[model samples]
Target: MAAPVYQAPPMPTDAEIARDVRREKRGRIGGRGALYLAATAFALFAALPFAWMLLTVFKQNSDLYDPNLNPFLYNDPPTLQNIGYLFAQTEYATFIRNTLLVAVLVVVITLLAAVPAAYSLTRLAGRWGESLGIAIFLVYLVPPTLLFIPLSRVVADLGLRNSVWSLVVVYPSFTIPFCTWLLMGFFKSIPWDIEEQAMIDGYSRIGAIWRTVLPISIPGLLTVVVFSFALTMHEFVYALAFVTSSAQKTVSIGVTTELIRGDVYFWQSLMAAAALVAIPIALLYNAFLDRFIAGFTMGAVKG
Candidate 1:
């Protein structure tokens, strides 16, 4: 028999390959466009309330109450009267000062307590540390309402009642538990080999943590700071329970207690206060957002 003629497999034509490439490029563009649309919609949904609040602060009472005018647009010229009134009429400035003081103190206390506790739990506790971390988080899950009654007596016994110092004392109770849990996870995400290497290089365990772990954990620390500060600023029940005087009231309590009277709302001033309080937090969150996300997500995943 004659040797069979050699045969070659067929290859795709250039036009066919080009057509497939175009189809893939179009699918990718379509997928990306859908994602962009979805993100835009979610951003607008989250931002519209803040936008309305901002608009309300700038709006005059006439424009605010006018049903015929567009609610989203200013029909009348804006004025600074509400901002002025908030400063002049109420103890708003004092409230701001008091809140700031409490927040700063709480942040300091939380970071100091949480960092060491988290480090010990994550790095030193051996195998029980993971379970203990979860247990600590569960303590945070205990509602403040449940603990405030018992805590109130302690505050009273400590002679901290009616004082801003009471807040500095009480705020840490709630803040430290969650912060410690958060940082335990964060610390776990750090490699143990790095610390071991530092120790091998003559650094003490504590020194190793200070030099190696902390430098890498700035994001986690900032997340804790921001969270604690925001909590201190907004905590109403404890602030209300411990403080009665306008001078000691935090921003949340001050705005609610002073701004509205007998169903009449000072719409503009209330909105202005909300805007002012929210703006700083918004700025801080935006600044640390990427790091915050990274810290929390990595910590959770690793732990």
Candidate 2:
């Protein structure tokens, strides 16, 4: 019998391969376009409330209360009356100053405590570091509501009651744990060999951390600072519980306590204060957004 004829499978032509590549490229482009559209929609959705608040800031009292006009649109030309009112009529300036001072203090305290604690847990603790990091994080997960009562008592006992200093003291209880956890992840992601080399070159562990590790960990530090600042600025329950005086109140408490009276609401001035307070934070976040995301994501995954 004749040997069966052997045949090779036909090879894909270059034209066919090119067509397949083109189809795949189109599919990827379409998918990316859809993703962009979806993201844009979500951003708009998230921004709407802020936009409304901003618009309210510029609206006159009449325009603000007008039922016939669109709530989201200005019926009349914008006015600065609400903005002027916020600065002129109320102790808004004091609130802003108090909030700023408290926020700065909290950020400073958090960084001071968290950075060292994080470095110790991640670099010095060896095998126990990871467990310690998680344990610290778990503390952060404990509801502030549960702690506020005891914390209020502690603040009173410590003579911190009704002072911005009270917030400065208590804010760290929450911020430090999260900041330390965040920094621990960031610290773990740093290669140990760099520190070892620094030690070999006559630097102590702390020196290496200061000169080598810290310089490289600016992003992580910024993340902590921003987080701590935002927390202090917006924290309400503790601020409300600890402080009753308008002069000592942070913006969050001040705006609510001062602007809203039972059934009456200073909607325009309230929104104006909200917008003004948010602007600095929004700017800071936007400025460091890339670094924040990088530090947070890398630290989270590696840790």
Candidate 3:
């Protein structure tokens, strides 16, 4: 017992603790650096097509057509001729106008129909809401290719064929169902308490929805707008089937139909058209990206 010495165990010095902390800090910094590097790389990869389109927009025909020259660089002096041709030679402006008109109309129609339907399904339909919501979403999953033939017949019956109004009428069929389903998911995520509180405070159900619910669901509404607009803009099968006139065509149809002759491809003008349209849309999506993502993430859940 006497030989069992009472020796204190060694404790870490402040320097040692400081060194360990520095090592952990370095590890975290290294991880973040790797993450940043990967993000930048992916961003560059995603941006490659736009960059190529931008370069092609300014490239001369010689520069673009020469197979031997690098596609990413200019061999000849850069010119605005492609953009000039896109504006001056074709019905590009008309296409842009028609596209905007159809997209705006479709967005309006989708919001009007989807919001009320979604609200009713979420708040009033009770347990049957989920089943009905899925049924509505299934309607959206029906491929446009399958539906276009019948839709074409409908367009003919309605005297909307060969008209932009045809697209305005047709685009909402899909947009509304999909948007309603999406909005149902979003609405279900909202608490009943807030709505009940509003009602208790003398707001009608409609008034509560208009004032409290909708203002909180801006992300969902914007998501619907973006989806509806983008769908209208990029819808080619319906546009081609229902509309044929160059003046009535949207950008997706007009640029290809007008720019490409039987064999000849207007590469520069095509790229220019794509660039001008894609860039602005890309900017818009980026602007609302957080909200857009939040909406979709919440909407993927079944209501």
Candidate 4:
């Protein structure tokens, strides 16, 4: 063994090390570039429909109806005729107003009912909380199509038939249950120690909730608001069943009914109406995207 001693291999040179480092950096840059390219592709794909709608809203009917022309490009000068027709010839403004009113009222009502229900189920309801929470969530799964007939009678009895107020009344029945379940997940993710610490500082249970729990649950609340508002705007079954007057109609019903006659369709004006309503909601979703994702992901994992 003593006679078998040998010299060790030499260390790499400065040039070799520098070359390897550059190679690694290049690999990382290539990976990041690929990821960026993929992300950009996905963004464009998602935006394609919106871009098409925007273009169609301004396109002339002749260009739109032409079979030989490129649908994606303008074959003629853009005009505001479709937009003007939407505003002037339809009850689109009324639809928007009614939709907004219902959305706002539904959001408010859902928050009021859901927040406390979620907190109670999460904290106060000893061992039956999960069972009760699931039962409430099951109510949301019942289709509007099945319930609309009975709901219509209730609406008529309340004299809210053919009124926008009927939507305000009916929308919350679904919104509250789902929102309560959603908020429960948020509340569960919050530590009990935070509320207890607030209580130790002389705050009552209600005060602790108001100061500590609710503030921490802002993301959940925002999720509720967005869900309620979107549902109210898009709901057609109940809206159609209970409300028939053009003055009481929402965007979902108004656009289809007003713009589509028995055989004729106002394609450009319909697209214009859709673009107006959809663009703002899309912007809103983008604005609160982080919070919305946090709300859903946290709720899903925690629940």
Q: What is the TM-score of each candidate against the true structure?
A: 0.91, 0.92, 0.90, 0.89
Model 3 spans > 4 angstroms off: 1-23
Please provide, for model 4 over 126-163, each residue's C-alpha lDDT reduced to its tens digit, 9 standing for 90 to 100. 78998899899999999999999899999999999999
Model 3 per-residue lDDT tens digits across residues 36-80: 999999999998888888888899888787899987778899999
Which ranges of candidate 2 are over 4 A from the true structure? 1-22
Task: Kindly list the per-residue Cα lDDT of model 1 for residues 207-287, writing each as its tens digit.
Answer: 999999998889889889988998988898988888988888889999888999989999999999989899999899889
Order of candidates by lDDT, top first?
Answer: 4, 3, 2, 1
> What Cα-based lDDT does every candidate model obtain?
0.90, 0.91, 0.92, 0.94
Candidate of highest TM-score: 2
Question: After aligning candidate 4 to the native by TM-score, how far in Å is the CA of 32 from where it should be?
Answer: 3.8
| 1 or 4, greater by TM-score | 1
The C-alpha local distance difference test score for the whole of candidate 4 amounts to: 0.94
Worst 10 residues of 4 by lDDT: 1-10
Best by lDDT: 4
Clashing pairs in 3: none
The best-first sequence of candidates by TM-score reads 2, 1, 3, 4
Greater TM-score among 3 and 4 belongs to: 3
Better of 1 and 3 by TM-score: 1
